[model samples]
Target: MNIFSRRARLGNAWAVNVRLRIAQGKIATIASAAEPQAGDVVVDTLLPALANLHSHSFQRAMAGMTEYRAQDRESFWTWRTLMYRFLDHLSPDHIAAIAALTFMEMQKAGYAAVGEFHYVHHQPGGQAYDNPAELSLQIIQAAALTGIGLTHLPVLYTYGGLQAQPLAGGQLRFGNSVDAFCDIVSLSEKAMAALPADTCIGIAPHSLRATSESDLRQALDLHAGMPVHMHIAEQTKEVEEVAAMRGARPVEWVLGQCEVNEQWCLIHATHMTESETAALAKSGAVAGLCPITEANLGDGIFNGASYVAHGGTFGIGSDS
Candidate 1:
C-alpha cells in the first residue's frame, strides 16, 4: 500500500512520479500519480548521488594549513613534507574527528561515498597499534558516524624504490614488508565488517616510488577481485626516476608487468606519453582526477580534454 504518490520534475527534462510504498527501509515501488493517502508523505524529486573516488581523510585537517611560501622550491613534494609533519600529531581520535568533519562536508557537497586511500596506519613513531589496522578502523568509524559509504583502500607501501631502500623519515609510519602489509590488509577487511557490509576493500600500492616489483605483485595478487589504485607518473622527477630504475616509463612498465583492467583506478597520472595515455584508456580503468587539488598543488593539468576524447571513463575525487 503506497502511503504517498506525487508527480515530480527531475533535472531539466524528466518527470518522475513517485509512489513510495515503504516497508521497513526499502522503496516498494514508483509510479505515476498525484494523490496523497492517509498519513502520506510525498517528495519532489530524487536521484543517485556521486562517489568521491579518492580521499586522504587525515589530510582534510591540513587543508589551507600549508599556504606559506618557502624560499626553496615550493612543490607537491614540499607540501608532502608538511603533510607528514601534520600526521605526526594525529591520534586515532583526532583522525576520526578530522575525517568526520571532512565527510560531513563531502555529503553536503553531494558525495554519497568516499574511497579513502588510507595509508597512515600506525603510531607517530611507526609502531603497530593494538590492532594493526587501528588507524584504518578509525577511518571506518568516522565514516559510519558521519553516514558516508566507505571504500577502504589500505595502502601497502614497502621499499623506497626498486632498490628496496629504507623508507624516508616522513614515510616511517607507512612502512610494512610484503607479508606484514598483506596481513594488515586482511585485518582491514575485518575492520570493515563493523561498517556497511557493502563496503569495498581495495589495494593501494602508494606509488612506484614506494614499491618494488615483487612487492607490487603480492599486493595485486592478494587483491582478490577488488580494484587496484596507485599513484603513477604524478611528477616529472618520478617519471624519470622510475624509467631510470626500470627500462620503460611508469605506466608503460606497469601495464607490461601487471594485470591491469577495469578493476583499477590510476590517481594523478598527470604525466604520460601518447602511447601510455592510449594504452591506459584501452585498459578500461577509471582515472581518479582531482582537478581542484591538482590546481592547488600546481601539479599541472591532466590532459583530460584528450583523455575524454579517447573514450576514457573518469570520476572526480576530492583527494585533499
Candidate 2:
C-alpha cells in the first residue's frame, strides 16, 4: 500500500509531500519530499501511531458508571469498590464485546497496538471455567476482530491486600495460585497462536500489594525475555500499606527486589520520592503513565520533569 501525505511528520521533522510504502503489515520504505504517485492513498497529515502501554479493556464498559461520587470522599479506593461490583456482573462474553469496542476506539484514536493488562479471570463466583483461559481467549478474539497488535498480559493476582489477605467478593475472580496462573499463561499462549505473529503474551504480577514476594519471583522466572508489567505506587493508601508491611515504598521495594530493566513496565508509579524517582530513571524500565485515569481517581501527578531530566523512558496508557 502506498500512502502520500501533503504534510507528514517523519521522525523529528515534518516534510512536505511525503510518501510511505507499507508491505505486509509494516512500513517498508519512506520517501520524504517525494511527489504523489498513482493509486496513492492521500492524506493531509500523517504521523506514527502510538502504543497504549497499559489498559484494562474490560473497564472500558464502566466509563461513565463510576464518574459520580458515591461516598463522603470519592477516591481510587471508592472507585475500585464500584469497579469490583461492576465486574461481578460481567461474563466472558461481556469482556469480549467490551474489549472489541475498546480496541476499535484505540485504533480510531491512532493507537496501532495495546498492552492489555488483563486480570479478570474465572467466573464471578471464583470457579474455574471449563477452559481456564476462557477470558484470555476472549481478549485474543477481540484483538483479532479489531486487528490491533496485542501484548496479552495475564496478571497473577493472588491476595486482596499487602498483608496476604484472603480474596473475597470480586477479588475471587482474579485470584489464582502461582501454578494455576502459570497454566493459564500457557493456555493463553496457545490461544494467541491464531492471531498475528506480533500478537504475543506477557505476564503481570498485578501489584506488590496483590501478590507476595515469592509469587512475584516465580512469576518473573516463568517468563524470560518477555515483557513484565506491574502496578506500583498508584495510590497513597497502597504506598502506606506496602511500606508498613514491606518496610519500603512500592517502587523502592520493587527496585530493591527485582532486576528491573528495559523489559519491565511499571504502571502508575505516581507516588515516588526523589531517590525512588532517580533510581527508577536509571533502572532502564518504562514508567507507564495513565494521566486521565490518575486525574479521575485523584492519584497524584507523576514526577515527569525530574524523571525526564534523568533520561527516563515513559509511555501513556488509558488505564481505565
Candidate 3:
C-alpha cells in the first residue's frame, strides 16, 4: 500500500488523498480522496523518483580524488589518466563494495533506476576472468542488494583512436573482438536471469573513435533492436577526430549510417552544428545528458534551449 499528497509533490496534479493498493509488487489500483483505515500505513510526505540514464558505478570510489590539479592544463584526457589508474587495481571485491555503496547513495538520492554503462570487463593485465561477466555480475549484485532497477549497458571498446589504432596501455582492459563481445553479451544476459524482472540489457559502442563502422553495425545487429547508446561529440577533439577520419561530423555520420529512433540515446552530444542538432532532434533519439559530470570535466554546455524547442528528448544522469 502507498499514499501520496499534493503538498509533498508526490501525487498527480488532479489527485487528492491519493492511495495505491499494491499487489504482487505492482500497483493494482490507484484511488483519490481515499481515507486511511485499520492497519493502514501512512507517511507525512513522499516524492517521486528518477532514473539515472548513464553511470560508471565503480568510479564512485574515486570521486573526490581526481580533483587535484597535477598538471598546468588538466582536461578530460588528464582526468581519464587518473580514472585509469583507479580502475587498474580494482578486484571483483572492490567493484562490489564500491558499487553497493554507490547504488545505496543513488537510492538515498531518490533514483529508482540506474543505467550502468559498464566497461571494466577484464583483469588488470587484460586477461578475461573465468566468467566474462564477472564485473558485470558484481554490478548486478550491487543493484540487487540496493533494490535499484538496473539497465546494464555493456560497452564495446575496440580501438584507441579515430584512425582505428590498436588498444594501448590502460585501454587493453576494455578491448574485445566482435565474437568475444558477443560472448560477453550472451553471458551477461544469462547472468541477469536470476535478477529482477525489470533488469534490462543494452549495448553501448564506446564512442566513434573507439569503434569502426563495421564494428558499430555488428554491435547493433547483435543487439536485436534493443535500446542502443553511444558516446558522441563529448569533446571537441572527438568531433574534429571523427571529421578528419570519417569525412563527416560524428552525429552526422551516425544519422546517415544508422536508423536512430527512440531506441537510441546519444550520450554527451555536447558539440553539434545547428543542422546536426535539428536533425538529431527530428530523429527521435534521446540525448543522454550528464550535467554535473560535464561541468566537472569542462565539457561545454548542451544546446538545451534549441534542442528542446525542436522536441528533442533527453534524460539526466550523474555519469561518474
Cα error, candidate 2, residue 257 (Å): 0.8
What would the per-residue lDDT of candidate 3 be over residues 1-320, giving only the tens digit for each residue?
A: 65444333445554456666777867677666778655556756445678899999888989898776777899999998888888898999999999999889998999989989989899987899999888888988888888898999998999988888998767878989878888888888888888887799998899999998998898898787788888999899999988988899999999999999999999999998988899999999999999988998889999998999999999998899
Candidates by lDDT, descending order: 2, 3, 1
lDDT of each: 0.82, 0.93, 0.87
- Tens digits of per-residue lDDT for model 2, 1-320: 89999998877888898899999977889998899989999999998889999999999999999887766788888788889999999988899999999999999999999999989988998999999999999999999998999999999999998779999998999999999999999999998887877688899999998999999998888888889999999999889988999999999999999999999999999999999999999999999999999998889999999999999999999988
> How does residue 87 of candidate 2 score in lDDT?
97
**Model 1 lDDT tens row, 1-320:** 45443454434555445566767654566565445667777665656578999999888888787766656688888898888888888889998899999999999999989999989887877888888888888888888888888888989887766678887766878988878788777887887777765487888999988988877887788775888889887788888988998988888988899888998999988887877888888889888888877887787778877787788788889998
Model 3 spans with C-alpha error above 4 angstroms: 7-16, 22-28, 33-47
Total backbone collisions for each predicted model: 0, 0, 0
Which is the better candidate, 2 or 3, if ranked by lDDT? Answer: 2
> Which model scores highest in lDDT?
2
**Which pairs of residues have clashing backbones in candidate 1?**
none
